[model samples]
Target: MRQGLGTQLRHLIDLLDGAVSAAYEEAGIDYRPRYTPVMRALEGGEPRTVSQIAEAAGITQPAATQTVTLMMKQGLLEASPGVRDARQKIVRLSAQGEALLPQLRLCWQATRAAADSLDRDMPYPLSDALAEAIAALQTQSFGARIRAARATTKSKKETS
Candidate 1:
């Protein structure tokens, strides 16, 4: 039977998550799935507030707060009072977290190498295409549309 597009997309996400988790495990790092997306967003070298990280990670503010708290407790992140907003806390990777970047990169490289080994013919091109797809999906319009659609569907279901 042919899978629906949603099912295929979900499966692809599951595969990627599993691969990434395994890579992190092999590298002897504790992989917090919820925090990975936020950390990835911080790769641009900018310190972000909890709300900003929540938006980037597609999670709720409370979820982001909890995740940040956990990471801070684990020495993976440092939080300080925001310069502009006294009520908000700015978060950034701690020295220990920064020190782990090289190891994280190595894990990512191993994961990429494994993926490339699976498809020897056009690995680089396939990787490039995936990167392009991710970049395209990162647009604000794409995310806003997705959120709106979900909200509409939920409201309709509730009324029914």
Candidate 2:
């Protein structure tokens, strides 16, 4: 029997994750798949709040917060009080984090090259297709439920 589309996609994701993780390890960098999206989101000119980072990263606020905390401790990020809202904090990458950006890019490039080499004869469109699929899935009911659950968990953690 043929495997389901979701199963194939999941397998692909797993393979990609492993390749990326191995690349990061080989490059002597701590691998955090979750942090890459958040860092990429913050690559824009503006500094972002934890909530904004979470939204951009497609992760729950609590997860973002925890990741931010870890990055901060690692000197990869710095948090400053917001100008208009004293209670709010804005997060940005520190010098160390900025320095690591190129390494991250290299790791991605290596992973992409590996994927491309898997089927050299065929034109590989998986990256673009996967990105589009993710964007579409983000607007679906399952995505909404996942995000809501993450948010709820974050809120509960904060309250406790």
Candidate 3:
């Protein structure tokens, strides 16, 4: 049987992330591609809450929170209470993270160039395809389509 779309998508993501991770390792950077968004968000040296970081990073709040926690443990981020709201925690890059900004910037530029090259070689660019797919899904969700298919099958079986 052909590989399912979800599985194929996940495999593609893994392949891309793995390649980037290998590049970081080869360059002597102790960073994961997953942390790139969070690092970029904090590169401006502004303290932001988890929600703000999540929005800026285009990731979920839970993912951002988890990343922040991991970065804190790795000495790449510092978390403190928000001045306006004591209960709210704000996060910013630590000195160690700031020190790696130059290297990260180079990596970011390289990654962007690589992606542009890949897009040029493809029939349809990956970013455009993904955006269109997301728009279609928003118009009619996968779950709804599956339910409709099930209903049609059930009706046909009953008629037969």
TM values, all candidates:
0.60, 0.65, 0.88
Count clashing pairs, candidate 3: 0
Alpha-carbon local distance difference test for all models: 0.80, 0.82, 0.92
Scored by TM-score, the top model is 3
TM-score of 3: 0.88
Candidate 2 deviation (Cα RMSD): 9.9
TM-score of 2: 0.65
Q: On residues 46-126, what C-alpha lDDT tens digit does candidate 3 reach at each position?
A: 889999999999888999989998889999999889898989888999899999999989998999999989899999999
lDDT of 1: 0.80
Candidate 2 lDDT by residue in tens digits, 1-160: 9998779988987987877787788889985766787788787646899999999988888999999998888888888999999899899988888888888888777766876776564576666666788778766866687799999999999999
In candidate 1, what are the lDDT values of residues 1-160, reduced to their tens digit?
A: 9998679878977987887887687778986556676677666668999999999887779988998899899898888898988888989988887887788778767767877875577646667776777678776556787899999999999999
Question: How many angstroms is residue 37 displaced in model 1 relative to the true structure, after the best TM-score fit?
Answer: 3.6
In candidate 1, which residue pairs clash?
none
Worst lDDT 10-window in candidate 1: 118-127
- Which candidate number would show the highest lDDT if scored against the true structure? 3
CA displacement after TM-score superposition, residue 57 of candidate 1 (Å):
6.8
